[model samples]
Target: MSLIQLYDTTLRDGTQAEDISFLVADKIRVAEKLDELGIHYIEGGWPGSNPKDISFFREIKKVRLTQAKVAAFGSTRRAKTTPDKDNNIRTLIQAEPDTVTIFGKTWDFHVREALRISLEENLELINDSLAYLKNHVGEVVYDAEHFFDGYKANPDYALQTLKAAEAAGVDCIVLCDTNGGTLPHEIPAIMEKVRATVATPLGIHAHNDSECAVANSLMAVACGAVHVQGTINGFGERCGNANLCSIIPALKLKFGHECISDEQLKTLRILSRTIYEMANLIPNKHQPYVGNSAFAHKGGVHVSAIQRHPETYEHIRPELVGNVTRVLVSDLSGRSNILAKAEQFNINLDSKDPLTQEILENIKDLENRGFQFEGAEASFELLMRRALGTLRHYFSVIGFRVIDSKRHEEEKPSSEATVQVKVGGRIEHTAAEGNGPVNALDHALRKALESFYPQLRDVRLFDYKVRVLPAGKGTASMTRVLIESGDKTSRWGTVGVSDNIIDASYQALVDALLYKLVKDQEQAG
Candidate 1:
């Protein structure tokens, strides 16, 4: 089996994503993580692109990467410029990386349309770019920009472009799905053609426009490619690039490739999530390796079989991918699921107590009311703890009210909330205002709790989401709320349900804070 080298551009191509920007310090932080995760190469950023990128390269040296080479990314030289004189080449030199990758137009259409240059000039562009990077760095990689589409249009010209890169002595030639239009089946033949033409090591760079970037990249590797370039969580232009999360595990477990260490594999899930959260984006639910729903079983028959034998329904064990197997509690959850989940919560359903029936009935009722327990583990924890006599309350709200007015003829309504609560068996009075009454209530509650438990300082609301119950039909409009909070490495999620949005938010927030307090106590003990 050919050893596949993973090249990560999460800091480079990843930043091109809409509304995605990384601080120079943030890029360095992720770079350090990738290095520790044992990725072969980390593409910092395009030094010539902007000030932040330049600063990233300047600051990146301060970080130490164990098993990765920092590769600087940029395009090839201009239509008519020497390697030393080209501004792009100087940017690559200034980056001072051990490796530099420059992409040039391989498609005839892009040369004539985008660059307004002749075919011969475009060929020179590819050759000159690789030579320029080679002169400065020990390893130089050239990307056949739009190689797949170029091959489909003019196979001979595309092959010639790769040949030019090979003749220039590039360390690797990467085939790019620039427009991300290539399919998995089409990659095998294209790779075969490119392999037949070029002698240098080949790489695959893919994008997720067709939602097959990872599949296409794997196919390319199956054919002959040795280097795979991607971004964490598939962050890139358009639909994004091939996701490294799926690529790494696929190569390591299924393909006999040893790119990253087992320890790195453990960190892969957290790293993927960290990148997503920093990007201010939600992790894709269906993302193969580290997705929340990747290992979740929702079917009743599958759940039953899983209880009898875990391998009955799972392909890859969830733990191998730094994810946990989740028995999704929905209408699909059966008696087996109830037992398994109850056991996980340390609740003895066999106690033959009325509380067992009560708990199960409450689960059905709350789920019917739109409270999803899959992510609301805090709610489930509270339920089980309450049943087991292990749960403790940080504070209990006495009464809360929302004051609104319709005094103005054409003005948006204002919301102010007042809440009375008991903390540590003592009354604490506080009032806070927020954009919404719920926010005000949350602020007030936290302010009151802070007096008693100052360590709650690390706990802050990370996310707030609401969903209307699908099964609601009566006058009581059941709404479900999920609140996610975090403190350093610990994340707590809680759920609540009510017709009133403020009430739902308050409930979820309180549970979330209380759960954090409980977990902190557990860790301390």
Candidate 2:
């Protein structure tokens, strides 16, 4: 099997995806990850496009990558302009990278329609640009812009353009599915014909418009391509580009091809999660290789079989990608599911015990009442403690009251809240004013308890969201609230549902504090 090179254009093409912008610091962080992941090439960004990318290219030069070469991206030199004087060309050259990827127009229509250059002149442009870069840079990659669609429309012209790059001694001729509308079966035949003619190393650059970028890239490899290029998390123009997360493992395990180190295969999950967190974007749970829920089991049959032998249900071992398998508990959960979940919850459960049935019944009732403990492990932990009588109360809620009033236009809207609590044998009274009655109430409660727990300084109200249950309809029924908070390392989340929104919020708030308190206690002791 041939060794394939993995090129990541996440910082450049990935950022071009709708509404994605990364800072210079994060771009550097992402580059570090790509290097750590053992990618062969990291296309940092276009230097002239934005200040952030320009700064990133400059700073990244100072950093060292163990296995990857940094590549700068830009278009070919402008028409009737010298490559040295053209700002786009100059930016790529000054970025001073190991490999420079310049995209040249391959589609005759794009040349005629977009560039308004004659077909023969367009071929000259491709030749002159590649030749110029070959002299100045260590390696030159020619992305034949819109190569796939152009091949379908005007095969002779597209081949002529790629031939131009090959004649110019470019390192690789990258075929771009710029429109992302190409199908899988269309790959091999097209690639086979082109590979027979072009002696240049072939690379595949696909988009996700049809959601087949990974599959198509794989197909191209089978047809004789050596390099695969894409952004992380399938991010790019339109729908996005092929996701390197899928492409990497697909090449390694599926095809017996190798691109990254065996160690990178271990840390893949951590790298994927880090990128998503820094981007502040939710990862696709079903994303093939590194998704969190990739190996999760919910059905009774799958759970039973996986319990017998993980390979019965798992395609790859969870630890192979630095992730662990998850067993979800829900309405479909049987005794095995419950037992497995209990084990994960650290709650002892004898499978044959009557308590198992009781816990299941309680879970069903809670689910019906709009309580989602699947994501709220803190709430579920409290349930297990209450059921087992193992939970110890950390604080006391003695008495609380709130007063809301609105003065004239000159005065600000305000509400006052007070809490009276007895901690250990001493009584503490605290009061505070806030923007809303609930806010005032929360402040007062925390103030009253802070003396007993000085660690509350690190704990905080990070985020709060409320959802009215479907049972409410138009009447006064119940509301569900999810509260998330964190300290330094890990974040803990909890939920509460009640007819009163304030009560729901309070319940969730209480769970957050109690969980943190318990964690602190565990660490201290």
Best by TM-score: 2
What are the per-residue Cα lDDT tens digits for candidate 1 across 1-525? 667899999999988899899888788888888887888999988888888888988887877667799988888888877778888789889889878988988898898999999998888878877876776689998888999999999999988898888988999999999899888989877888777888899999999999999999999889988999999999899999999999999998898887887777888888888888778888787778798888788666788798788889877777886898787766556666666677875556763567766666777877766778888877788877886687877678888776765579898666667778797669977777777677777777777778888888888788888877755555466788998888987776898888877788888988888888888888798
Tens digits of lDDT, candidate 2, 1-525: 789999999989988877778898988989998888898999998887887778888899899788789999998888998777789888888889889999999888899999998999898878988898898999999998899999999999999999999999999999999999999999988998798889899999999889899888989898989999998888888999988888888888889997876778888888888888878886777877688679888777788889889999999888877878888766677777778877886678998999888887898899888887656777777777778787777767787778888788888778999889787788899999888987898788788888889887688776678888876366587898898788886777789999988778778878887888877877798
RMSD of each: 2.8, 2.2
Q: Candidate 2 regions off by >4 Å?
A: 402-416, 433-441, 460-463, 475-477
Local distance difference test scores for all models? 0.83, 0.85
Per-model TM-score on C-alpha atoms: 0.91, 0.94
lDDT of 1 at 272: 87
Q: How many residue pairs of model 2 clash at the backbone?
A: 0
